[model samples]
Target chain A: MDLIRFPEMSRGELRALRQTVDGAFREFTRIWGDPLENLFAPLARLLTFLENLLIDSPWILVLAVLAAGIWLASRSWKIALGSVLALLVVGYLGMWEDTMRTIAMVAVCTLVAVVLGIPVGILMAQSNRMNAVVTPVLDMMQTMPSFVYLIPVVMIFGLGKVPGVIAVVIYAIPPVIRLTNLGIRHVAPDVLEAAEAFGSSKWQKLRDVQLPLALPTIMAGVNQTIMMSLAMVVVASMIGVRGLGQPVLQAINNQYFTMGVMNGLAIVAIAIIMDRTTQAYGRRLQKHAEAGK
Target chain B: MSAPQEQGQAHGIEIRNLYKIFGPDAARHLPAVKAGLGKEELHDRHDHVLGLCDISLSVPPGRITVVMGLSGSGKSTLIRHVNGLIAPTAGQVICGGQDVAAMSDVRLRAFRREKTAMVFQKFALLPHRTVLENARYGLDIRGLPAAEADGRARRWIERVGLKGYEGYYPRQLSGGMQQRVGLARALTNDAEILLMDEAFSALDPLIRVDMQSILLELQKELRKTIVFITHDLDEALRLGDKIAILRDGAMEQVGTGQEIVLRPANAYVADFVREVNRGRIIEAQTIATPAAPGAALPGFTVKARSKLDRVAQRMVEAGAGAAQVRDPQGQLLGVIDLPAILNAMVNSADAESEE
Candidate 1:
């Protein structure tokens, strides 16, 4: 019996396997490089444009927009003022442009994640087979090292803000999909029955009944997706995605604790601001749904 | 109230030879089940739960047919089958000449949209929608334009007594009020058939009674063919033109409240009626004697349709030993004596306790 022992395979077969894989990657790049780059170039350009716009825009206008958004979401002038003060403190630490850049990237990544994830989640909710198929894939995406996705992302999009956005999307999409599926599933069966009894078609039920009821849960999922996107920022910075993450990376490399702490605090500020806004928005939607009734 | 006439062309519902065995492969046990396997026997031998068996009944048009049973007696399953929500293992549900169980998806959708409306026990109003929106749901589903649907919904909202609360969402309403919205939604659909599955079972006792009266009041004017499911015998007696009593998925008895109360078809039915107050359900005509030949009628006359309890109340108030029972047109039909009413109320209690 010619069983290949692990140690023996490590000496010769491992090297062979590495060569085969490396050759496959090279051949794949050779064949698919132009088409793939062409597909991603527009997206890359959009990301670059957004990041630069945020970084170069006048800081006062950006802060005003941010504060206004916070105020709208929270329905509280106090929260808006507090967020503005916190953001101004970050600016005083000389990280205003970087903070805006980070916010822009997080925004794009979250948008892409929501756009792609919600449909997938609805599909999963509609069919148990789809859920069974996607659940393990989601588990892998969530639990596997976020850095591991960057390897293939770098190979495909080739080291830029696009690759960073792609990485963030991959990291952030699972929660929305899982939660959206859960939200749809958890809608009371009696309500669905009432809809069916009233002769709601499949599409009508989804639009008028299921999705509306599921909105709060889906919003919670969006909140988690945003948080996850922010968590990916420093890792995304590694592939030349410029943002506040860049300085934190530099601080780590140069062992400069103060720079790391200051940049880290800015990221935290952004995260807190985003989290509270999303949560407040979700609560408002719930209140609006129940308002007057 | 009337004899079981031919249900043909009347837009009534007839469920024939219905049998529902719940299992992964209920079809496989059909032969064994039809050959006289009992519910527990099926469970122990085939690991299958029997949901309904030989549930043959006819729901008269413009009247309520109450299917009464305890929780697992398959009353819910029976009501759901009317709308094709649950398919029976074997049966035919002929509603408006369409075999509901045999309907294809497209035809079934049409049947549901055009022919029927349902009220739920949970008052399943869409929480996200306002009272007006929820009420308009059925019309909206039928593809009516929003303006038309809204107009129809508003009429029903007022009819069901939620006129001022049109913009209110379900969460802001109390339980009884939510059920009013549910009733409004069903009524606004204007379907010929209304299926209510324990529609008032979730309400508080006082609210349940209030809702029941509201339904009775609406039913007088609308006269839709309503199939109402309930576990409460009193509710069945109050609402059902004909009540079908079920036990372990089999029909134990099918009759009017008077018929079932006076002459139970079997032990299961007798047990069910044992706790019922006879005076509340037995109509004046049921216990009325023939009028004294060529004699003057009593001073007070009770309507033939009036229950014995109400008749007793009127008789006691009028200080009469016997009251003439009159048809709706005021012609004397018979006379109900006070002793007969007392005997009915007391003897039944004594008979039940003696058992």
Candidate 2:
């Protein structure tokens, strides 16, 4: 080793490796560009359409709608009042429009992720081979740094709200899938055997027994997905996706501490509202299941 | 609707050369297993746990066939194979003249729906469904109309003595009541073959006795081909029309309860019957003296099927020295004296001690 001394070659080798990786990716993109665009365009259109619908609504009406949703989910007037108060504070702090945009992004991202993730998770639960394949991918998705996703997302979809939402969906999807798989797999073996003995078809067993029992756990996953969606959407603002994150990003660039603090609080307040509502709803569902028995 | 006719009921379930080996590549070791390799040896040599071994059993219709064994004796596996829940490595499960193991997917599904029902040890009532809904499950799966299914379910619920609890959830009921719902659900299916895998093992002693009696009473009219599995020898004796004893995945012996208790075939069967109350299990036919063709018949009579314990009580109460044993048709088949009944009640313990 002393004789070889490596010739101080590490930097050159690393540069060459980076160049090779970049060339390979470029070639992949050149070959797969059309199919990839076709695949993502519909998703991008759907997300943008939802974003417009939410952000275009009047502030007062939107606030009322959110407060009512919170009330329905939590079944507590006190929680509803707190949510309303938080919304008003965000408005007073001049972050109302930005907060709405962020909420819209999170809602759509979470919805899309759940719709796609649950069935895949069910498939995973039904087959050990599928589960074996999906588990490592899920581990990577959950553990990888959020910043790592933006490069691929922006490179494919280009910068904007669509790319932002795509990033958020990628970041938030694993929890729902993992939890749904776990919930179905964790259903009592006796219950499943009973279903089998009763001549339940595979679909019937899944729908009648597995899904109903797994609902609370899946709802918990939805809550986690929503929370992760919110976080990812804020970070997504770095690539020109406007929301509360935009103001915070601006504040960071220019050292405007007040703007940063206000926007940050707005995001936190939104997180708290969603967390309490979803958790309360999950508890109510569990109680309802118990009472049903 | 007319009552379920005796003809339409399944004749018998015939399990022939049944072998179950659990683990990947289970079939690869079937030859070695059937050739006489032990369960432990199979596991060591081929990494397959033998679940059943050459189990040949005939479960007669219109009777309760109780398969008795301790845990890991493969009784559960054997029962599951009857309903095609578990496939055998090498065997034929002939149910209703159709090979259950050989049925196609669609046919197996239909077989399960139209011909069989099961009562679980855990009383596997759906937690979210009310008692009535749980009872209605089999009918619902059969695609019966809601109104008609509800009526059938309600009747079974009432029959099982869970009348007022139809609207209550499974969690709202006691264990006994929940099992009643399980029974009601199984009955509502009206399937000819009822597979009860340790159906009453979870109940308290008193409740277990009650459920056993209920099952026996209903079975008198239902005449379903019921296969009951249990670890308790007492339960098997009490409920089984014929009992099959299993040990370490192999069938040790199979016969009437009286035959098993009176003359155990092997050490394993003997150990199982060692603590059994022989008086209750030994039928009057086993100890009855032949009635003379022209001799004067006794005034008092006992049923040929009566257990020794019951006939002994009757003889004591009536103060009869001897009683004619009448068959179900009331024909005098034989005579059972008080001493014979007494001997059957007391001699079992002596016989065991001598062994």
Best-fitting candidate, scored by DockQ: 1
- Candidate 1 docking: what grade? medium
lDDT string, candidate 1, A168-274, tens digits? 99999999999999999999999999999888889999999889989999999999999999998999999998888999999999999999999999999989988
Tens digits of per-residue lDDT, candidate 1, B228-283, equal: 99999999998989999988899999999889998999878888888888889888
What is each predicted model's overall lDDT from 0 to 1? 0.89, 0.88
- Global lDDT for candidate 1? 0.89
**Count of backbone clashes for each model?**
2, 3
Question: What is candidate 2's lDDT per residue for A1-293, written digit by digit as tens?
Answer: 58766567688898999999988987877778668777878776776676676668887887798889999999989889999999998888787778877887788788899999999989999999999999999898888887887787677667787778777888899999999999999999999999998889999999999999998899999999998888875589888788889888889999999988888888999999999999999888776356434
Deviation (Å) of A259 in candidate 2: 1.6
lDDT of 2 by residue, B206-267 (tens): 99999999999999998999999999999998899999999999999999888898889987
Q: Which ranges of candidate 2 are over 4 A from the true structure?
A: A3-17, A24-49, A288-293, B1-7, B291-298, B348-355
Taking the candidates in order, what DockQ does each have? 0.59, 0.54
True contacts kept of 1: 0.73
Interface Cα RMSD, each model: 2.0, 2.6
